[model samples]
Target: MKLGIDRGSLVAWDPDGEEWVVVGEPWNHDLPAFLADGEEAVRKAERTFTNPERVSGRAPSGLPFTPASLRAFALWESHMINGAKGMVAAFGSPGVRRLVRGFEAVTGRVPPPLRPRANYYREPQFYMGNHRSVLPDEAEVAWPSFAQVLDFELELGVVIAREARDCTPAEGLAAIGGFVVMNDWTARDLQWDDTRRGTFGGVVKAKTFAGAMSAVVVTADEVLPRWRELTGRVLVNGEVWAQSSTASPLHDLGAAVAYAARGESVGPGEVLSSGTLPGCCGLEMRRFPRPGDEVRLELELGAGKPVTVTNTLGARPRRATQARHTEVARRK
Candidate 1:
């Protein structure tokens, strides 16, 4: 069933009627609490909406709930491999680009090292994201001032229903409360530098500045089993940019969550993303979103309505004057 916050109240979406029905009392905008209640919340939404406690016209949708924590895992090997090639094409130094092109021209494939590491098959690997920076669907997303090449990644976010620690994969799967379409906004230029030079190995400024999630969420019961059959598309300024699917991943979200819960706890309302879908990122497509572009991510899961997350890119900020490191060193 479709669930979200509408007009400051928890509501269930009726696709056929195109209306929002207020869920019963005690289920306010507290989505984490609702999810912590587990199956009871679903039953309440299902039953309460049956009689129509209160109905309202379509209003601006709000985030179902702010995530308690956010973790993104890179699961698709093809996205990684192709994304590497696209990076080399877009940001690699001239000599490196020539070498890569020559290597591809001769071998007809990206170098073996560029492929997903064998350890990726052995376990789930991920980076923590700034949960507080998440933007709602249809919200205006601004590029971070320091970045020039902004990009978006179409991904699936799994909402954790309850606290899990040292759990089995099945238990981890059971912990999923719902799923939401996710757009992981990236600063490609900053990411390139951070990836190679930053003391911290993985993405930092490139990813954590901002992200977007669908205003509505589909219950896990309705999505889990059929998730692999789902397909997705990315559109930039109303034009289709790429097509994708959830068909293959070295590790399912359940495994990723299970691995995450090895020692630390993965709590309710924490969002764990399935990383970028194969070919679903501008980084893989060789075209990035510019300011004023409307980037929309749509997922066809056979749900009543196709889940979509749309955000309009905002203009880059003007640079401000600042003292250089060299000047500071000289003064010291």
Candidate 2:
């Protein structure tokens, strides 16, 4: 069953009615309770229905789940290698040499030629994001005041169904509840600035802004049959910017979740994202989106229909007025 939030209420798609039916209480108040209930919560949504509502006039397409935490990983080798090369070029040869020397000194071993990207092959690289910044598909992304270059990453997101710690890949896979098409909006300029300063945590500020996701969540059972055949695409202003098969990633979702749960607890309602797919971002193509441009992401999960999310770029909110306006516009 597909689930979504509608006007602050938990809702499930009523295929027979072709409308969103109120399944439970408002998500903000019911999320914790629902997550604690796990599969029972889904079963309840399936059987229980109150007010049936049509989605025709809804402003922001409500999120399927409000994640307790958002964690994203770089699971594709091509994206990592190309991104590393871009950063190296930006840093210049002298800076790159110093970076390599610093790594060698710390590890007491000669670092590979592509020092940083090589490290990605050792394990899945992930970063925590601001959960509060999650947004619905129709939301407009305000250009961050501190960012001059903005990009969108096409990805698949897994919603955890249960708490997992020090779990194996198979266990991690079993913990997945559902999947969504994710658009990881990024402030490329801020990311570059942070990387140059040797502070990787800058991703929190760069990536936390109004990232978009599909309106409905598809259960694991619905996705498993087509998991290896999923394809992802990114379009900017109606033109295809990048395309890739989800199966092309070097690391799978299970490994990403296992790595994320190593010594750390990943709980239900937390989103684990399959990072930018190969060639799915401007960092690799040297092209970035500008204000007024529309970015769209689609993930074909072979569930008869593809999950899609779209966002329109707006100017940076440098003043309180613009900020409030953006917020109001997002809820339209």
| Top-lDDT structure, candidate number | 1
- Per-model root-mean-square deviation over C-alphas: 5.6, 7.7
Clashing residue pairs for model 2: 59-332
Cα lDDT tens digits for candidate 2, 1-332:
56656677766665655555666563443544454555677676656543344333232266766778988887777777676654444433566658866886899764555444555777888888777887788788877776666778888888888788999989888888788888888876667666656455447577876688788776776685577678878888899888887676677778888999999898888998888778888777766777889898888864445678888999855542221112111211
- Total backbone clashes of candidate 2, pairs 3 or more residues apart or in separate chains: 1
Stretches > 4 Å off in candidate 1: 15-17, 52-54, 57-60, 320-332
Candidate 1 lDDT (Cα, 0 to 1): 0.80
Question: What TM-score should be assigned to candidate 2?
Answer: 0.77
TM-score of each: 0.91, 0.77
lDDT, residue 272, model 1: 96
